[model samples]
Target: MKKLVLTGAAGRLGSYLREPLSQMCDRLVSTDWTEDIGKLYPSETYVKADLGDLEAMEAVLDGADMVVHFGAIGDEAAWDKILHSNIIGAYNVWEAAARKGLRRVVYASSIHAVGMYPKTQRIDTEVPHRPDTYYGLAKCFAEDLGSLYWDKKGIESVHLRILSAAQVNNPRALGSWLSYDDLIHLVQQAITTPITGFCVIYGVSNNDRVTVDNHKAAFLGYRPKDNAEQCAEEVLAAADPADPHDPGQMCQGGPFASVEIGFSGTASMNIVQDKKEI
Candidate 1:
């Protein structure tokens, strides 16, 4: 690829993606609301922009091969906050990418888009969305937006319903964790696949205890090498036994499913706040 664009370049996941993406493409334009993302990688340039801003997005997207859109409020937040950053921001990215004639958009959608589904059911990519929070709802909106664009504008997209892409710190993570290496591999698959009209792939690993099924998306060739199974014994030992009656523990969304809508789930979530700047 000649040029690639990445939103949320300052985020934890983006921190890991910067170098690899730069290596794959001739030029990588990394953008975020921040003034800087610390240091730049080879073939990577920084641009300050917001996903909610159409003009800025258009300018950054010009001449790009594909866009890795991870720029959003990563956690559950107020309705207005989710609206501006998640909902509107997603639209701007798609609109800008389509206008620029980009081949595809690899979106950072969350598993929360199907969080309300029970983990016991073992759902696949074809299942209808059942968002558990405003944040999850935004993912659904973006995925639908990607589909609409593909159907109407002939623009293609790949929605990665990421389960967990951070350190495996809790019991729930054993089934949902996605290693950084696996994430980079997933993006590469999304961008290099010969033809993907509009696809949805779960961003997860080969964990032995997984609840979400990825059999339908196997064609993307995202064979994850890393697995959360290694940490299962340790994590499960320290974690409290899951209550079947508890909606949060029983559902695919975990804590997000039990929390009230428009409320913060970060405090309850066992997420690693990786602060190191790339």
Candidate 2:
């Protein structure tokens, strides 16, 4: 690919992706609302653009072969904030990609989109959306938008419903954690896959206790290397006694299942900061 555009380039996950993504394409256009990302890799070029601005987003994606869209509120918030950054932002990316004739869009969707399901009931990519919060609703919208674009415009997309892409510091994370190495692997597969016309895959490690199934997305060739079970003992020891009846503890979505609409659920997880340079 000649060029690759990455939104949310100043974020924690984006920081780790920049160097790898830059090496894959001749020119890596990294964008975020932030003015700077501290430093840049050889093929990286920073561009500050808001996801809410369709014209500005189009300008940034003009010459890109593919787009890895990660820009958004990245939190549970008021409906207005989510509507702008997550909902409208998703539409803009898809529209811009279609107009530009990009190869594909790699999206950062979340497990919260199906948070209402019980932990015992393992879900696959084919499961219907069961959003738990407004933030989750936005993810469902984006996933559906990806589907619509692929069916109507022939634009390819790979939506990764990330469970928990953070440090494993609690019991819930033992089953849901998506390690940094695995995340890089998943993104690489999403980009290199030959034909991904609206594919959905679980963004999780190869944990023994995993609640989500990725068998249907085997064609994408996303074989994760890391496992959260390595930290299981420590995490379980640190966790408070879990109530099996509590939705937060019994649901596959963890804290997200118990949170009210527009409230923060990720705040409950004790995720450690990434040590990677941004």
Candidate 3:
């Protein structure tokens, strides 16, 4: 591809993806609400754009081949923020990608979209939506929007229902941890695949205790080599098992399920601040 556009370029996850994506195309346009992302990769250009502004998004995505959209509120927040960033931002991305004639949208969906489901269920992409918070509901909306555009128009989409892509320092990480390497591999697969109409794949690693299945998305050639088991002993030893009655523990959404709708669920967890650098 001659050009590719990536939103949320200032974020921790987007920061890591910039270089690798830069290597894949002639020009990698990385955009964020911020003026800069500290530094730039060799084949990258920075753009300060807001996802809520449909015209701004269309301008940035002009002449792009594919879009990797990780631009949104990363956690549970007030309804207004969720509505603007997650909901409206999503609509802007899909509509812009379709109107701009981009090949596909590699979206960052969340396990919270089905977070209310029991952890023991071992659900797959085929399950129904059960969002635990306003944030999760926004993901649900984006997933549905992706499907609608693919069905009505020809724009393709790949919704990655990410479990947890942070450093592994808690028990839930033992089952849901997705290393940065695996996250990159997942996105590479989502964009490079020859044909993908509208797919849903769990964003997880080869964790030994994983409860979600990615077998349906195997054709994408995403074979995660990293596992969270390496840090299992340390993580489990530092944290106590979740209470059976607590949705934060028993449900797939983990901390997200147990928190108040507008409150921060991850604030109480023992997640390590070990942001992996590229």
Q: Stretches of candidate 2 above 4 Å error?
A: none
Predicted candidate 2 versus true structure: per-residue lDDT over 226-263, tens digit per residue? 89899988878877898988999998778888888778
Question: How many clashes in each structure?
Answer: 0, 0, 0
Off by over 4 Å in 3: 273-278
TM-scores vs. true structure, each candidate? 0.98, 0.98, 0.97
Clashing pairs in 3: none
* C-alpha lDDT of all candidate models, in order: 0.92, 0.91, 0.90
TM-score of 3: 0.97
**On a 0 to 1 TM-score scale, where does candidate 2 land against the true structure?**
0.98
lDDT of 3 by residue, 57-97 (tens): 99999999999999999899999999998999999999999
Least accurate stretch of 10 residues (summed lDDT) in model 3?
Answer: 269-278
